[model samples]
Target: MQITQLPSDQRPREKLLQQGPQALSDAELLAIFFRTGIAGMNAIELAETTLSTHQSLQQLFNASLGDFCQVKGLGEAKYVQLQAVLELSKRFLQESCQRNTVFNSPEHVRHYLSLELKSRQQEVFMVLFLDNQNRLIHQDILFYGTINSASVYPREVVKAVLRHNAAAVIFAHNHPSGVAEPSEADKIITRKLISALALIDVPVLDHLIVADVSVISFAERGLI
Candidate 1:
């Protein structure tokens, strides 16, 4: 059945307007974004089919433009829209992180880091430069490639630290393999960063390892 033929209250857009965004299912929300559908399928049905193919919304959004365009009833225009929305959302999150202090705002830090690192196919090392009050100054991805003790150099990190003139920093990196457990190399590098940054009168507040399902915190584990 067509979405327009559905009961008014049951329609995705009407339901969203009557209640709230949180009240709707994933397919319903996606249907609202879709707005229209192919000849045989309604917007809701198309959304359902798309989600079923991707398995989850995260997997769907993380898909490359080419991969997503392969879906029925979608094209480059919608792909561009989706990517724009994603970039906007990330910027909003980054702004939110900047407004709050990381030490007292663990959730923001974790949430921001997850968005920044989780979808990456390769290992990336990033740093959140913080002001004296632990408020975020800026975030920089200093290294991207394979992650290891040798590859993540303290000298380059120290240079960035000096460049930002940050009073403190929270370190983070992603495990593309989806294991949040810190490796021996991870521990070794964290300790090296702690030692190197400490020499400049700056502290290493935490080292977070981002995996798909969870974020492992060295500070929470008593490693910091």
Candidate 2:
């Protein structure tokens, strides 16, 4: 059935306005973003088909331009819009992290890092340089590696911290395998970085391991 033929409250836009965006299913949300559908399918149906093909919103968002446009009702225009939306979300989260003390809101830190790193096809080591107040001063992706490992140099990390004049630091890296567990190598490296930064009187506050679905904290697990 056509979306217009559905009850007013049942339509994606009306449902969003009446109840809130969270009240809508993924398909409903995508339908609103899509605006229109192909000749035979309605917007909701098209969204459902797209989601089914991709398996999940994460997979869809992570798809390359070519891969995304291969969907029947989707094209380059939709792909560009989708990338813009994702970039906006990342920037919004970064702004939030900058405005507040990240240690005070660990979830925000996790969320920001997740968005930054989770979808990456390779391992990326990121450093979040924080002031004494724990507010974010700067962030940079210091190293990029293959699917499983990144070569992180403590000297380079220290140089970055010094360059930013950071008082403290939070280390985060992503595993493309979607397992949040910190490997023995991860532990060894965290210890090395902590020791390296300690000499400069810059404490390593926490180390986070980001996977596709979750973020794990070394400090929380007594690993740091």
Candidate 3:
């Protein structure tokens, strides 16, 4: 049955207003975003079809423009809109992190970096500059290279912290091979960076190895 055929309270928009966005299922949430459907289908049906085709929402959002356009109600305009919304979510997370003074939540850090770097095809080294209170000051990608290799200069890392006037920092990099294990080079680089930064009294809070599904922390392993 069409969504209109359902009871007034059962409609997607009505349900959203009555409860909350969190109360809706994936299909219901997607239906709300779609707003309408093509001939012979309702928004709910289109959403269901889309979910079925993609299997995972991440895969769906990551789909290429040409690929995503093949969907029934999804077109160029909608694709661009989705991209903007996704970017908005990333910035929102970053803003939330910036508002906190003491950054002790490892999971939140992992999640934010996962969204930022986990899906990259090449390795990227990032630095999170923090103030004396450990609040986030800035996030910058300092280096990028092939999946297995990235050149990180301890002097450059030190220079960046000095440039930002940061008192502390968390180092992070993504493993394009999907392994979060810290290689021998990763461990060596971490120690060298620690020694170099210590000369100026800046602490290396953590070194996170971001993989496809997991984030490994050197601090958690007593390596920091």
Candidate 4:
């Protein structure tokens, strides 16, 4: 049935306005974003079909423009809108991270890192430079390509920390293979970084590994 023909309270937009966004299902939320549908399918049905095609909202959000446009009733315009929404979410999370003590709000940091690194096809190392109070001072991707002892240089990380005048640091890296477990190489490089930073009296607060569906924290696992 058409969305307009449905009862007022049952409509996605009306439901959202009345009960807040959380009251709606994923298809209802997506239907509101869609606004309209193809010849036969209503917005809700279209949204359901699209979600089924992608399997999940995460897969849909992560799809490339070509892949996204391939979906029925979707196009480049929708892809651009989706990307904008994703970037806005990432920025919001980053703003939150900057405002709070990072260690105290570890989930925010994890979410920000996930948005930044989860979809990446290659390995990247990121460092969050923190003030003495553990608020984020600066963040940077210090290394690209393979993340390992040979590729990641402690000297460059030290330079960045000094430049930012950071009191402490949190390290993060993405595993394209979707394994959140820290490898032997990961452990070795982290210890080397710890030793290098310790000489300058900067503490390594945590090391996080971003995987496909999870962010693993070294501190949480007692690996740090």
lDDT of each: 0.89, 0.94, 0.88, 0.92
Error of 4 at 91 (Å): 0.6
Residue-wise lDDT of candidate 2 within 24-114, one digit each (tens)?
9999999999999899999999999999999999999999998998889799999999999999999998999999889998988998898
lDDT of 4 by residue, 1-224 (tens): 88999999999999999999999999999999889999999999999999998998888988988888887899988888889989999999999999999999998999999999998888999999999999999899998885332269999999999999999999999998888899998999999999999999999999999988999999998988
- Ten consecutive residues with minimal summed lDDT in candidate 2? 65-74
- Which candidate number maximizes lDDT? 2
- Clash tally for model 4: 0
The global Cα lDDT (0 to 1) of model 3 is 0.88
- Residues 1-224, model 3: lDDT tens digits: 78989997779999999998888899999898888888899999999898888887876777889888888778998788888988987887788778876367666687789889866889999999999988889999999888797999998898899999999999999998888999999999999999999999999999999987789999999999
Best-first order by lDDT:
2, 4, 1, 3
Which residues of candidate 2, in runs, are more than 4 Å off?
A: none
Q: Estimate each model's TM-score.
A: 0.94, 0.97, 0.90, 0.95
